[model samples]
Target: MMYKKLFLLSGLVLSLILVGCEFTKKTVNNVNLFTIEDDINLGLQVSQEIANDPKQFPILKEKGNEDVYRYIRKITNKILNSGKVVNRNNFKWQVKIIDDIETLNAFATPGGYIYVYTGLIKYLDSEDQLAGVMGHEIAHADQRHSTKQMTKSGALDLLLSAAIGEKEAVKQVVGGIVGLRFSRTHETEADEYSVRYLCGTDYNAAGAAGFFKKIGGAGSPPEFLSTHPNPDNRVQEIEARAKGMGCRGNSTNKTEYNRIKGLL
Candidate 1:
């Protein structure tokens, strides 16, 4: 009986390993363990938990900040509808602008939840720049960077703990996300997605590259810029990506962006 039990347990572990190692055929961000559904549920659970923490919620929250959020949603909706992304139909997309203007940061979770600081919006010069940031973040969400990172960063253990209903494991996953940064390869993949998503839209394909150039030139990297690859390296790659796409004569929408800033 003991020998049979051990065999069954080993088989279960091996099966889980196989599931996690299953690879998709996509050329970008293809390596992942969690199914789209698993990631979506994980993201929703974490987002809800984070939203419940009063200290965790940004000041002003989303209730009185509809205008800023509306502008962000407009950009996100347009990009999402561009049909350039994978797993598009698998998740419900949403975007929010945090009230903090000094943070200069933005991030997206596994599902479709994206958050941008007011500072990134104010710091940028044009709607194209905003699109650049938004597109990059949307790519992060679209590509399931959070889950990829989690899987790479001990999320397998967390998943097991979660299977056993370990609350601390859930907390650890949430806390880990706040400082999560993608690997260079993953960052590049997300950038590629950003460039592609912006191409057919009203925004320029090089918006992301331009934003990287500005941040690099400015010399004071914000938290958003901190975890990314060196701005110079990213800018060069983004330029190359933009050129490969044969994109030209893009709109910057500086006037409209200024108005959005004013709304904030």
Candidate 2:
């Protein structure tokens, strides 16, 4: 009888080990399953919902602002065509300017839809500064960080359900999980990608450091810092990375920059 009980315990332990291994494998595989196409589709769906919702910010379309749109398109296209992004072929990129002057922010939807607020543009001193901001937003899309966040949220919900032994509790778990902010690691990773993208392109990568410093000292957190690392820390990281790449201060894109600046 003792031997029989011992055998049963051994089998149970093996079963638990197998289950744990499978769960780990699933989580790792799901992380890799995120792709640019998936991100774009998710972004599009979210954007459409936001567009339909009256509470969301209105899409900007001032009569004389066509020039502003054209200027943004020209610069964005130049950066996109630079071939620095590893997954650039996967996106059908689009840029839109928000008319709101008080909101200094920019965000990228999963599908390559990027929105930049007029306030952000007004604060930018040069084209490279604008590119630096846009590049960081693009990096978030390229990395599919949102998808990973969503996946992790779902996984946590499942784990919570199992721990409580009640499927009905999953909704509460999910609600809390969704509200959980991303860790510092994700912000750092995005910053790294942004700098790398800028480095291989015509955009002055070193200018990114200055932009962060300006934003930090501008009496408000940087737009990029809204869902990212602290601006001060980000500036330091950018400065270190830029120095390593041999990029230095006050690089010029003055001609094209002035044209865009005039529109603002």
Candidate 3:
């Protein structure tokens, strides 16, 4: 009986090792093992929750809104067309501006839902600067950072469930604590991806560097700082990335910039 139990225990241990290796492999490929369909579903659910929350800024709607959307779409298309974004074909991209002037923040959800606050737009002096911010947020989606976070958290929950003899409840907890940790890592990697993508686009890569400069002295830290890298550290990283890519200094579009600035 003892020998039989040892053999069964060894088999279970080997099985877990194989399962762990598979999970790690999926995560390392820069791709989430979960399907885009599932990601979009989760994103839609979370987005609805955010929309329902009182704290989220209201979505903006105005006359000539399509024009603004079209212009931003053009810019997004340019970057997406440049082959810099990963899994470009897998998403339906949407950008929304919240009409909140007090909050300076932007973020991208899985399945390509991006939100930018008007306060952040006001801070950007040019279209390229705007692109720098948008690109960074979009990079988070392209990297599937959120989905990967969900996957990791899910795996951990499964392990915990099995340990507690509640394997059936694993899926219920998959999108828990582990997901939060992955989300943080995804934010940092997306920052790097943004720098790289900006280098190849018409957007002034140095605008990214200058962006940090503008935000650095802003009296109070904004909501963006909670999940984003420190502006000072981001500026240094942007400078170094731009230097490696041969992008130097600000290259503003005077005409487009003035037009956008006039609106603010």
Candidate 4:
């Protein structure tokens, strides 16, 4: 009877805790149990894991690759500093380059930790194209899509466990962030936001579609496509949206972009 009473007490405490800190839903579709602080903390934990796992991440050191880092960060900063993103100052907005030349992908952890593979840089034809891709990744984090997806996947129980100081529950949530495949609705939203973010800058607002256009022309699919599932007619849809939004500049900056690509 003692063990049963302890269980009841624990359950009562959890219920009381949740009553004060209930899981809230954003205006967006999914349920997001995490707060902004939670996103930042979780992202930092995942980033530490990536930093420790050199074999898988193989992050390029900034010492020898200062220029490359600067150029990429320039693109990232442009989008973050665009005054369009809501959590612009709240997130870290740091950039890292993964050394793999064959993996054409970039991703952002919640609270703005960005990672780009060297292959993605090399594969793109212009700086604007890279900016487009970066913008999309940024949108995913800014939209809090990862945590929303987690909440839908029955993470509320784990979060409640975490609330009671269960470290392992927190670790499980962190582990799941990296490999998440965003839904088509999230992908479309990211793409649209990418255009909006770049629209305020010099680059073509629809430059992300350029990545899709190039990939469509290629014989095999890119690793980026594996994680970021392309919606049907995505390229056309992005271009049309850019036009409808009256996005102005179309600077590809291919010459300077090519020079930087050689550095990779």
Candidate 5:
């Protein structure tokens, strides 16, 4: 009886490993064990958790902040309409504003749930710059970087537990995403995709480069830079790519952007 039980357990482990391998094989750029559906579910779950935790998230309510939400939606919609995002129609793509002026950062969850800090919105100079940041964050979701990072960090066991309907494991996975740090390679891909996404729009293709230039020239890194480390020649690379693509749109719409800024 003991020998038979050992054999069964070994078979189960092997099966799980094979399942993980299969999922990993299906990913686009890296070894991601989660499927697109998994990303949607996980992002939805994490976003709900964030919504409930007002002390931590402080999401600005759309009740009296209709204009702000509308402005954000306009920017987000332009990028989404650019036709470059994967799973664009399937993912939620909900945008939320976290009302914290001190934290200058923006992030997207696995399935296109984006949260931007007020500090980041206030800090940017023009509409195109904000659009650039939004595009980069959207790329992170479209590319499923969070799950890829989770796979790399040995969260396979946790994922397996979640697969087996372990509720606590799911919660842990969702909770662990509070401050997930993406790799430099993922960051670069996001940056490149930002330009690519913007290239399809009227916004400046190298708008993201402007943000990097400002922060790098400022000499003091904000929370955004801390998570997204500005490597050498990042600006040059972005500008060069935009120029190489021959993207003609250079409209920053600074006057209108300043008007929106005044509303906040």
Candidate 6:
């Protein structure tokens, strides 16, 4: 009877706590309990691990490789600093060029550390497409998708404490961030933001469709695609979105993209 009473009291306390705190449902942009500082520290730790592994995953830090990185930097930074993105001053936005010339993917870690594989870069036709890819990834970061994912998964209680400043848990956190397969709604939301970000910039939002069309389904889906929407249908939606948003007459800058390819 004593044990039963303790359990009841514990439940009552939890209910009272919830009532006092006014705990609400977790929404796309509103469930954020982790502070911005947590994301920055987490991103920096994971990015450092990726940068150090040269044999398994080469960093594009060889001689005369600076210019291409600069080109990518300019594109990513432009979108990051485009004022279309909220909290522009808080993010530590940096783009890393992974030397994997086979894996056609790019991902953004929390607090705006983006990784672009060389294969995807080579596969894209122009710089505008590159910007589209970057913008999509940045949207994920801006939306704090990882934190929301953890919260929805019910692991935020356990992981939040470890995720902050815990180097040993870096792999787990990084894996969750990179391998997170966002829902269809999440994908659509990011796609919309991709168009918006490209709209205000020099790049055409339609360039996003080109990249999606090129590799709609090259191989089996990875973790990022487990919940991803169909790329073929996504291309059509993106194109229509671009037109609806009046994003015509935007520049692709194929000339500069050609130079970037040549430099690589």
TM-score for candidate 5, residues paired by index: 0.82
Give the per-residue lDDT of model 1 (tens digit) for 85-145.
Answer: 7767887676666667776777777777777888788888987777877788778778787
| Number of clashing residue pairs, candidate 6 | 0
What lDDT would candidate 1 get against the real structure?
0.67
Which predicted model would earn the best TM-score?
Answer: 6
RMSD of 6: 7.3
Give the poorly placed runs of model 2, Cα more than 4 Å off.
1-35, 155-181, 217-223, 226-228, 247-251, 254-259
3 against 5, candidate with superior TM-score: 5
lDDT of each: 0.67, 0.60, 0.59, 0.75, 0.76, 0.70
Model 5 has an lDDT value of 0.76
lDDT of 2 by residue, 1-264 (tens): 533442343222322221122123334424633455556555555555445543455677757788888888876776676667766888767888877777767777655777788888877788777777787777766666555644433343333232343433333322322223443555566677667767766677755565677766555453356434667888888768876876543445777777766666
lDDT of 4: 0.75
Error (Å) of candidate 5 at residue 66 is 0.9
Residue lDDT tens for model 6, 1-264: 433433333221322221121223336435665788767766787787667666755778745788888889899877876678875788788888888877778888877888888877887898888888788888888876665554444444434544564654565555555556665566677787888888878788776777877766878654333325688887888889989989864788898898888766
How does residue 238 of candidate 5 score in lDDT? Answer: 85
Count clashes in each candidate, considering only residues at least 3 apart in sequence or on different chains.
Answer: 0, 4, 1, 0, 0, 0
* Candidate that would win on lDDT: 5
Worst lDDT window (10 residues) for model 3? 170-179
**Per-candidate TM-score against the hidden true structure:** 0.81, 0.71, 0.69, 0.82, 0.82, 0.83
